[model samples]
Structure formats: C-alpha cells, structure tokens
Target: MRTQVAIIGAGPSGLLLSQLLHKAGVDCVVFERRSPEYVLSRIRAGVLEQGTVDMLEQAGVSERMRKEGLPHDGFTMAVGDTRLRIDLNGLTSGKNVMVYGQTEVTKDLMDAHEARSAQVIYEAENVTPHDFETDHPRVTYEKDGVSHEITCDFICGCDGYHGVSRTSVPKAAITEFEKVYPFGWLGILSYVKPVDHELIYANHPNGFALASMRSETLSRYYIQVPAGTDVNKWSDDALWDELKIRLGAQAAANMETGPTIEKSIAPLRSFVSEPLRFGRMFLAGDAAHIVPPTGAKGLNLAASDIHYLSNGLIEFYGEKSSAGVDHYSQKALSRIWKAERFSWWMTSILHQFPDLGAFNARIQQSEMDYLASSHAAQVSLAENYVGLPF
Candidate 1:
C-alpha cells in the first residue's frame, strides 16, 4: 500500500489528524492495534478546553458534541468547607469549557471516518514504523496471518505512552521527564444527577475529590487514594461514603448516589518526551506527553498536538514547504510544556502529597486562599483552564 502519511493508533489524536489532513486534500491511513469496541471501552476524562471544542468543530465532528455536551462558564474549587467558583467565562472574556466525554469524541471521529470510507485498519498486529529517518518512511503490520507494508511520505505516532511509536526511537535521542504522584484517583461513573451543575474540584483535609459529569444525568466522580490501591477493594457504597467525607457537608447533602456503571483507579503522573519529531516520524498525544487529570488537560493536550501537526503537514503538502514540519517539535513542545506546568500546578495544589509535610499542606491552603481572594490569580487560572491560544 502507498499513502502520503501513515498514522499509527486510531485514537482521537490520530483520527483527528487524519480527518483534518483528509479535509485538506492530504491522503493518510490510520492503523490501530485494537478493535474499535476496545478503544471506546476505555473510559477517560470528559472536560474539554475551549480550544479542543473548536478543533473538533474544525474537523467537522462536533455536531453531537455541541448538541449533547454540557458547556460551563465556571467551576468551583473547594478548600475544606470553603468553596470559590472560578468564573471561566467572566475571567477569560466569555471563554468557557465543554463537558464532553473523550469516548464520544472518538466515536464521532470514527463515525466520520467510516462514512467517508477512510482507510482505518483496526486489529492490526505488530504495527511498526521503519525508515522514518529517510525520505521514504513506511509502516508494517500483520492481519489474519498476513503481513503488510505501507510506504508513505511521513509517519505519525499517536499510539500513546506504551505504544511502539515512542519505543521505536533510540533512547539517547529522546530525553524523558517524569514525576509519578504519590496517589491515584479512584473514579466511578454513575447514572445519577451530578452534585452540582458545574464541576467541583475539592481539596479536603483527607484528600482530593472531583465531581464531574458527562451529561445532566451521568455523573462522574473521583477521590484521591494512596498509590497502588486496588479497585476491587472499594464497593460502590464504600466509595460514595468516602466522597461524602472529602467533598464536605453541603455537597454531600446534594450528592445523589447510585449503582456505578464503571469503576477504576488510575495513577497520576506527569511525563514528557522532548523533541516530538524524529526525522519523518513525529509523536503526538500520549506518545509525546502525559499530564495528571487534575486540570483536565490530558485530552485537550492531545487535541493541541493534532492542531500543530495537521497544520504542519497541510503546509508541507500545499505550499511545498518543510518549515512547518521542520519546526513541529519546537512549536508543539512550547505549548506542551505550558500545559504540563498547569497540570502539575493543579495537581500539586489539589492533591495530598504524602511527603510534603504539614508545613507544605498549610502552604497549599494559603495558595488556594490567595487564588480565591485575588482576581489576578483567578484570571490566570481561567486563562490556562480555558486553554491558551492554539
């Protein structure tokens, strides 16, 4: 097979890039190691930065999102019993976020691909990119006991953290920065109305808790737990009891409990692999970096990666220019680092760090107090929260 671009991973990042490039008249093919069902089954964060929502629109896949997704002008931040709403719209001059699940976004992109009969190969085994350092890059994979190869002008790795794309590069060529948090988030999805209309991020004396939702009736909630905690240990009722304690008296009073549809514990980490480009192959999304979900930046960061990458590829094909692709790494990393910083800061302030002693805990409280009282602090938070300009 021959194509202009061979994309690895049919996740939102790769799918969005292919959608944009296709719309721009650039041919590309996507390869996924797992079936579409498996991909959609993985539950993820739902909060969308304004920029992410716009990019979905740009890709012509935001119809369902705009119709069903919840839009919020602000969200509340709680320190113990005190709550302060960060007015995202007022602080950012009407900018706000959309509460849309990552799963739905992927489904929309996948539907678009299917409707267009785009080349998206699922359940391809051993997908690998080779000769990315040369002018001609190709990808190889096996399906149903048959091996196949696709030669393309470039290769894009949106395959994620454990994907072959990043591992394909020599270790010495990539510099990795990572910090594993001391705790993990025990999250549950329930079919009950949310405690609040908008999301609430709470920092309690015990731990951190987040009350978020996918829709008016679908509640998603999380509470911080020690690292390596087992999901099987906590029953639905037990988890809800913990949430009540951490979210405070008022929120707990309003909170509705129900049978959880899904439950999992995910560890928090901040990781970035520098220089996203390696010759003709480039890394996007989780393949390039990861942020703790504290600031709801994981999926948004991926969308931003697709933005820079698709633009660069479009420029390369349309104008016969390599400038965009040449500087893809630098441009993407600049924005990636900022998001990493914001996610790190949000995680630091909201999560209970085991090693950070009581003095640091007081300092965290002071910082939250300052953020609540100071307009400048709120503005800064709102700006970063709504997302910086793409």
Candidate 2:
C-alpha cells in the first residue's frame, strides 16, 4: 500500500492527526498493535486544556465533548487544613478547563474516522518505520501472521513510550531527559457524586490527594502513595477511609463512598526527547514526551504536538513549503519545556517528598501561601493550566 503519510498508533494523537490531515485532503493511514477495544479500555486522565478542546473541534470530533464534558472555572487546593480556590476562569480572563475523559475523546475521534472511512489497521504486529531519513519513507508490520508494508512520503510516530516509534530512532540522534518521582498515584474510579463540584487538590501531612470527576455521577480520585505500592493491597473501604482523612472534614462529609470499579497505581515521571522530528518521521504525544499528571499536561501536550505536526504537514503538502516542517522540533520543544516546568513545579509543591527536611516543608508552605495571595502567581497558574496558545 502507498499513502502520503503513515501514522503508527491509533491512539488520540494519531487519530487526531489523521483526522486533521484527512480534513485537509492529505491522505494517511494508521496502524495499531492492539484492537480498538483494548485501546479504549485503558483509563487515563480527563482534564482538558483549552487548546486540546479547540484541537478536537478543529478535527471535527468535539460535539459530544462540548455536550457532555463538565466545565470548571476553578479548583480548590487544600494546604494543610485550609482549602484555597484557584479561579481559573477569573484569573485567565474567562478561560477554563473541560472535564472530559480521555476515553471519550478517543471514541469521538474514532467515530469521526469511521464517518470519513479512514484507514486504521488494528493488530498490526512488529510495526517498523524504514528509510524515514530519505525522500521515501515506508512502514512494515505483520498482521494475521502475514507481512505487509506501506510506502509513504512521511511517517508519524504517535505510538506511546513503549511503542516502536521512539525506539526506532537511534540513541545518538536523540537526547533524553527524565526524572522518576519517588511516589505514584493510587487512583480509583467509581459511580458516585464527587466531593466537590470542582476538583480539589489537597496537600496533607500524610500525602497528596485529588478529588476529581468525569461527570456529575462518575468520580475519579487519587492519592499519593509510595513508589511500587500494590493496588491489590488496598480494599475499597480502606481507600475511601484514607481519602476522607486526607481530603479533610468538609469534603469527606460531602463525599459519597461506593464500590470501586477501577483501581491502579501510576508512577509519576517527567520525560522529554529533544528534536521531535527525525528526518521524515515526526514523534508526537507520548512518543516524544511525558509529564506528571499533577498539572494535567500529558494529553494537552499531545494535542499541541498534533497541532504543530498537522499544520506542518499541511503546509508542506499545500504550499510545497518546508518552513513549518523544518522548524517543527524547535517550536514543539519550546512549548513542551514550559509545560514540563509547570508539571514538575506543581508535583513538587503538592506532594509529600520522601526525606524532605523541615526547612523544605516550610518553603513549600510559603510557596503555596504566596500562590494563594499573589495575583501574579494565580494568573500564571491559570494561564498554564488553561494552556498556552498553540
């Protein structure tokens, strides 16, 4: 098979890129190592930055999001016993975030793909990109024990961290930066009303906890746990009990407990690979970078990557200009570093670090206090949270 672009991975990044390119009349095909069901079954963060929402709209796949996604103008942060609210809408001049699950976003993109009759080959095994550095790049994979290949002008590596896309690049061609946190987030999803109308991020003596919701009835909550903690060790009641204690009295009083439906522990890490573009192959989303979920930047960063990549490809195909394509790496990396800093800062301030001294605790408290009191600090947080312009 031959196409203009071959996208590896049918996740949101690849789907969004393919949809955008399809709308722009650029032909592309997607290859996925797993079935659609398996892909959608993976639970992920729900917070949506403004730029992500806009990009979904640009891809013509956000109608359900606009209809069902909850909008939050602000969130409350509990520092010790005090709960302080960060008014995102107020601080950012009416800009806010949308609470929509990543699963729903993928579904919408998939639906749009089906409507357009776009190509997505699921269960493509051993997928590999070839000759991306040359004028002609191609992808090869095995399906149903049969080998197949696609000849394309360019390749999009949208596969996640463990996927073949990033690994395909020679180590010498990419410089990597990574920091694995000493903690992980033990998260649970349940069918219960959320503790607060808006999300609440709590910094407690024991640990950090976040009370978030996917909708009015679907709650997603998380608490910081020691690294390598097992999810199976915590019973449903124990999880709720710990959450109540960490979230404080008022929130706990309003919180409802229910049978846990999904539970897992996710390690926190900040990672980036410099030079997003390698010859004719471009890495987007988790393939290029990762961030701690503290600031909810992972998925938003993916959206920005697609924005940069799609525009660059569109420019190249339309005007036959290489300007956007040439500078894609630098442009994407500039915004990525800012997000990385924000996520790292938020994680540092909100979570309890192992072996942290009393002096460090006092400084963290002072930082939170200043963030609560200073308009400049609030504005900066709001702007980054709502997302910088794409």
Candidate 3:
C-alpha cells in the first residue's frame, strides 16, 4: 500500500492529525497496535485548554463536546483551610477551560474516521517505521497471519512513550531528559456530584488532593501517594476518608461519596525527547514528551503538537513548500518546553515531598500564599491554565 503519510498509533493525536490533514485534502492512514475497545478503555485527564477545544472544533468533532463538556471560568487552590479562586476568565481576558474527558475526544475523532471510512488499521503487530531518513519512508506490520507494508512520503509517530516510532531512531540521535517523581496519584471515578462546581486543588499536611469531575454527576478525585503504592490496598471507603482529611473541612462537608467505577494509581513524571524530527519521520504527543498531570497539560500539549504538525503537513502539500516541515521540530519543542516547565512547576508546588524536609513544605505554603495575595501571580497561573497560545 502507498499513501502520502503513514501515521502510527490511532490515539487522539494521530486521529486528530489525520482528520485535520484529510480536511485539507492530504491523504493519510493510521495504524494502531491495540483494538479500538482497548484504546478507548484507557482513562485519562479531562481538562481541556481553550486551544484544544478550538482544535476539536476545527476538526468538526466538538459537537458532543460543546453539548456536554463543562466550561469553567475559575477553580480554587487550597493550602489547608485557606482557599483562593484563580479567576481564569478574568485573568486571561475571558479565556477559560473546558472539562471534557480525553476518552470522549477520542471517541468523537474515531466516529469521524469511521463515518468517512478513513483508513485506520487496528491490532497490527510488530509495527515498524523504516527508511525514514530517506524521502520515501515505509511502515510494516502484521495482521492475522499476514505481513503488510505501506510506503509513504512521510511517517508520523503519535504512538506514545513506549511506542516503536521513537525507538526506531538511534539512541545517539535523540537526547532524553526525564524526572520521575517520588509519588503517584491515586485516583477514583465515581457516580456522585462533585464537591465543587469547579475543580479544587488542595495541598494539605497529608498530601495533595484534587476534586474534579467528568460531568455534573460523575466525580473524579485524586490524592498524592508514595510511588509504587498498590491500588488494591486502598478500599473505596478508606480512600474517601483520606480525601476528606486532605481536602479540608469545607470541601469535606460538601463532598459526596459513592461506589467507585474505576480506580488506579499513576506515577508522575516529566520526560522530553529533543529534536522531535528524525529525517522524514516526526514524533508528537507522548511520543515526544510527557508531563505530570498536575497542570492538566498532558492532553493539551498533545493537541498543540498536532496543531503544529498538521499545519506543517498541510503547508507542505498545499504550497509545495518544505519550510514548515523543516522547522517543525524546533517550533514544536519551543512550545513543548514551556508546557513542561509549567507542568513541573505545578507538580512541585502542589505535591508533598517527604525527603525535602519541613523547609520545603514551608516554601510550598509561602508560594501558595503569595499566589493568593498577588494579582500578577494569579494572572500567570490563569494564563498557563487556560493554555499558552498555540
């Protein structure tokens, strides 16, 4: 098979890219290693930067999102009993965020693909990209008992961190920077009204806790736990008790508890692989970088990557120019680094570090205190939260 672009991974990044490129009349195909069910089953963050919401609109998949997604102008940040609302709309000049689950975004994109009969091969094994250094790049994979190959003008790796796309490149060609946090987030999804209309991020003596929701009736909550903590150890009631302590008296009073629909513990990390481009192949989304969920930048960062990449590819095809693709890596990394910094900063201020001693704890509290009192600090937080411009 031959195509203009061969995309690896059918996640939101790849699917959204394909949709944008297709709308621009650029032909592309997507390949996924897992079944569609498995892909959609993975639970992820729901907060959407204003830019991400706009991109979904551009892709024509925001219908459901517009109808169901929650829009928020502000959220509260708490240090023990003290709470300060960061007025996202006022600080960012009417800019705000949408609370929409990543899974729903994927489903919308997938539905669009299916309706258009876009080529997305799922459950393909041993997928590999070869000859990306040359103008002609090829991807190969096996399905059932047969092997197949696709030759394309370019290859895009949206396959994620453990994907084959980045691993295909020589180690010396890519520089990796990573920091693994000492703690993880123990999160649960339950069918109950949220404690607050807007999200609340709390830093307490016990740890950091976030009260969020997927919808009006679907609550999603998290608390910081030591790294390598087992999910099986915490019963639903036990987790709820800890949440009450960390979220403080006000939130605890309003909080509602229910049977958890899903539960998991995810470790925090900040990772970036420099030079997202390798010859004819490019990396985007988790394949290029990862940020701790503290800043809610994970999915938003991916959307920004798709913005740069899709536009670059569209320019290359529409104008017969290579300039956009040529500078794609540099441009994408510039934005990527800023988000990495914001995510890192959010994680640092909000999470507790046991080994850092009491001095660090006091410093964290002081930072929060400063944020509450200073308008400039609130503006900065609002800007980053609503997302830096794409």
Candidate 4:
C-alpha cells in the first residue's frame, strides 16, 4: 500500500493529523492498533485548552464539540478550608476551556472523516517502521494474523511513549528529560452527580485532589495516591470514602453512585524527547512528550503537535515550501516546554511536599492567596490554564 503520509496511531493526535492532511488534499492512511470501539470508550483527559479549541474550530470539527462540550470560565482551588477561584475569563480576554473527554474527540474526528473511507484501518497490529531515510518510508504491521506493509512519503510516530515510534528514534539521536512525581492519581468514574459547575482543585494537608465530571450523570474524580499504589486493594466504598474525605463531605454529599465503572491509577510524570523529528519520520503527541495531568495539559499538547505538523506538511507539500517542515521540531518544542512548566507548577503548588518546612508552607499559602487576590497572579494562571497560543 502507498500513501502520502502514514499515521501510526488512531489516538487524538494521529486521527486529527490524518484529517488535517486530508483537508490539505494530501493522500494519507492511518493504521490503528486498536479497534474503533476501544478508542472511543477509553476514558481519559477531559480539559480542552483554548488553543486546542481554536485548532478544532479551524479544522472544521468543532460543531459537535461546541454543542456538547462543557465550558468553564475558571477553576477553583481550595486549601485550609478556604476556596480561591481563579477567574480565567476575567483574566484572559474572552478565553475559556472545555471539559470534554479525549474519547469523545476520537469519536468526533472519526465521524468527520467517515467519508474519507479507506483512510483508516483498525484492528491492525504489529506496526513497525523502516526506511524512514528514503523518499518512501515503510511502516510494516500485521492485521488479523497476516503481515502487511504500508509505504508513505513521511511517517508520523504518534503511537505513544510505550509504542514503537519513540523507541524507533535511537537513544543517541534523542535527548530525553523525564521526572516521575512522588505520587499518582487514583481516578474514578461513577454515575454520580457533580457538586460544582466547574472543576475544583483542592489542596489539603492530606494531599491534593481534583473534582471533575464527564456529564450530567457521570462524575469523574481523582485523589492523590501513594506512588506505585495497588488498585486491587481499593473497593468502591473505600474509594468513595477517600474522595469524600479529600474533596470534603459537603461536596460528596448526595452524590449518586452506581456500579463503579472505571477505576485506574495513573502515575504523575513529565517526559520529553528533544528534536521531535528525525529524517522522514516525525514524532507527535505522546510519542514526543508527556505531562503530569495536574494542569490538564497532556491531550491538549498532543493536539498542538497535530496543529503544528499538519500546518507544516501543508506548507511543505502544498506550497512547495520547506520552511515550515524544516522548523517544525523547534517550533513545537517551545509550546511543549511552556506546558511542561505549567503542569509542574500546578502539581507542586497543590501537593504538600514532605521536605517543605513551615516557611515553605507559609510561602505556598501566600502564593495561593496572592493568586486569588492579585490580578496579575490570576492573569498568569488564566493564561497558562486557558493555554498560550500554539
């Protein structure tokens, strides 16, 4: 098989990349290792940055999102029985965020590209990359226990961190920066009603917790858990008790409960590999970097990668200009670093550090206080949270 571009994953990054390339009239094929149902049902990531929303709008995929996505004008931070609301809308001129899951994005993008049949192949497996240095890069994989090969002008390594794409780039060719947080997020999704309109990030002496929701009948919540925690030990009652304690009993009150749908633990980490491009193969999304979920930056950053790569590919192949393509790596890295910084900031501010002395505690309190009281501080958080222009 031959294509103008070969996308390695059907995650948000690869799917969106294919759609953008198609809009540019670039012939492309997408190979997804998982079935479409799995991609649409995988529950993760619920915040859409302002920049990501803009990209979706420009790509003409925002009709469903604009209609269904929950808009948040700000986020509330609670610590020591006091709540501080960061007025994002008042801070950043008319900027806002959307509380929608990544799974919905996969569904929406797939629906938009429904007419572009033969562009996506699901249940594909054993994806391998080869001859990326040549004009035709080869991506070989097996489908239904049969071997196959796909040839493209360029290969997008969007499979993710654990997939073949990142490892395909030699360790010597890639400069990596990574830090694993001392804690992880114990996430739960229930049929409970949400207690608040927008998200609340609560910081307590016990730990940090995030309160969010998926829809009117679904409440998605998270509590900071022990590093390397075991999910098996947590029962539905135990999980709800922990959440009630951390998020406050009042907020947890009268929250409906059903069969605990999804309960999983996610490690907090910041990972980045420099020079997201190599030869004819380019890396985008989770294949290039990962951020701790504190600031809700992971999926948004992946969207930004597609935004950059699609624009660059169009300029290179459409207008016959190599400028955007040549500068793609450096251009994407700038926004990546900004998000990394913001994610780290949110993580550190909310979590109580073990080594933090009384002075440090005071400082943290003062910082949070100023963020609530000062316009400049609110603007800084607003701009970072709503997102910086990509």
**Residue lDDT tens for model 1, 1-390:** 899999999999999999999999999999999999999999998999999999999999999999999999999998854589999999999999999999999999999999999999999999999999999999999999899999999999999999999999999999999999989999999999999999999998789999999999999999999998999999999999999998888889999999999999999999999899999999999999999999999999999999989999999999999999998899999999999999999999998888879899888889988997899999999999999998
Estimate, for each residue in 1-390, the C-alpha lDDT of model 4 and write its tens digit: 788888899988998888888878898888888898888877789999988888888777888888888999988888765688888898898889998888888888999878557478898888988988678789999988999997888899898889788888778888999998888988999887887888989887878888898776688888888798999898998877777777777677855556688999998899999998888999999999999999899999998888889999999888999788778899999999999999998898888776778888887787788777778877888899998887
Q: Which parts of model 1 have CA positions greater than 4 angstroms off?
A: none
TM-score quality measure for candidate 2: 0.99
Q: Check candidate 3 and list the clashing pairs.
A: none
Counting clashing residue pairs in each candidate, in order, gives: 0, 0, 0, 0
lDDT of 4: 0.86
Local distance difference test, candidate 2 = 0.93
Q: Model 2: per-residue lDDT, tens digit, 14-75? A: 99999999999999999999999999999998999998998898888989999999999999
Instruction: Candidate 4: list runs displaced more than 4 Å.
Output: 253-258, 357-359
Q: How do the predictions measure up, each by TM-score?
A: 0.99, 0.99, 0.99, 0.95
Q: Is candidate 1 or 4 superior in TM-score?
A: 1
In model 1, the number of clashes is: 0
Per-residue lDDT, model 4, residue 185, is 89
- The residue-level lDDT of candidate 3 at 199 comes to 95
